[model samples]
Target: MKTSPYGAIAFRPDARRLTVSAPSGELTVWDTSDPSRPRPAGRLRTGRGIVAAAWNPSATDLLATVSNDGSGALWRLRDDSAPEGVARWAALPDRPRHVGWVAGGSWVFSMTGTGRTSVWDVGSGACVGRADLTGGRPVVGAHYRGSEVVAVTDSGWARLWRPGRRPSEWVRLTDRPVSACTWSSTMLVVGDLDGQAACFDAEFRPVHTLRVARERPRALACADDGRLVASAGDNQAVAVGRDGSVQWETYLRPPGAQSITIAGDLVALSAGRPRPTLLALATGAELAGGRS
Candidate 1:
């Protein structure tokens, strides 16, 4: 109900707020403190179009949204009013669609239109390093769990990049792209475009392939304690527990949900056209069903 599908979504660390970007060049935050009734707390407009949006983990009211027009702006919200511009920003030679906050630091990571990824020092807003990505439209987002940051490109490949030994030398993970990828604490679940899902280690080596639809999933979300939720274009979503149990199942039923997220025990889904709704994990039923 809060975020727009044209961009990206990042949940605040406390799970009380969410930031979403839409095709209208807008980014908004929703208050989820009371899951039974989510409310739009604040909103910000982006330049050009939003390529991606990410929430600052520790700072609940801060967010960074990147645009395809090659500019990144940091917005801070104190109340529901328009966001106040902040000090962090960047203008690159190429447009970037994916961005994330680095763990243990204020650095920001981004993937460019040319399939190039880079890290920036948020305080100084300077580029620290860069890596080449397997060419594609661009990555939608970058994820970091530990020391390694996983960047998934539009080509359906997951590239692992750690800090280079020296100045600009990055370790190339592989020439081959993984079909699909989502991460847990110690494991990564990769779904290929070929209609298969595989598990991999931190070293990017294959371990196991899982059973599910192999036809490329539309969205993927995982819980910190090791639960995986996947939804294809088919409108049905499946919750796969880490211990191998069915958590629940439900369909949005109409215009279809464009994206989903797990906050606490609730599954928040954004449906297209009609409106957005939140479902309880225990019953797979809507908590707040509102018209768009």
Candidate 2:
């Protein structure tokens, strides 16, 4: 089977559904009931490259995407046909780079290249709040967890804020710029260009740090068992235990991994390869021939 390079990947909250969006704006959903061989479930075309996507926490079939066309859209996937666009908003000053759902999918938020974050009401498709968070630095990545959003900038700063309020928790993660970030139930993990993954508590206190990659980590995901998985571009994908020890590392093909998702005991890596690669989260061994 032929496959285009993927720009981003996401798994449903339940981890049963996986979505991979290509640079051509084609989004494909996969049924991961058998993690080794994910069957294509559905597809949607946005007409522009998707930068990021997030699944609705409460509605499994609902997905949100931020596109290179300076728009954000919500899509509804059906079993019988291609997904439909339920709501879309455009005309932003900068292209949105990251998107996420909040308030149990009642609202959606996106962050742009200029550090502008906008929150839209899903029901009305109206942007209810907008804020500039750059503070003279470029935002590298952002993560939405619960009602709060954390934005990390190239200046090595991370700020936690809620809509209509100033940042309540802010911290300087490192002197080196951060590359990726993700949230677990009780912890926030940030990876830096220095090849380190740092864990912080709820109050922005440093808990521990693990060296996951030789250079920058392209993506980071926290597993259910408190392990940190990181993809280092052109390097390798690694899983680190809670004790700041390396659990396993699997080398990748050139151009390396772009994104990662962990569901149950399986880890899916979207890389330069033709198809996504599946690895055993516990042992880092390829599964089902490693192509899905």
Best by TM-score: 2
lDDT scores in order: 0.60, 0.73
What shift in Å separates residue 247 of candidate 1 from its native position after superposition?
2.4
lDDT of 1 at 84: 90
Clashes of each: 5, 0
lDDT, residue 287, candidate 2: 68
RMSD per candidate (Å) reads 3.9, 3.3
Over 99-208, each residue of candidate 2 has an lDDT whose tens digit, in order, gives 77777788888887557788888988777677776664677667765787778776678876688887655578777678777676678777788778888777778888
TM per candidate comes to 0.80, 0.88
Candidate 2 regions exceeding 4 Å error are 1-5, 78-82, 167-170, 233-235, 288-292
Worst 10 residues of 2 by lDDT: 1-10
List the candidate 1 regions with Cα displacement exceeding 4 Å: 1-5, 78-82, 135-141, 145-148, 153-156, 163-180, 205-208, 212-215, 271-275
lDDT of 2 at 268: 76
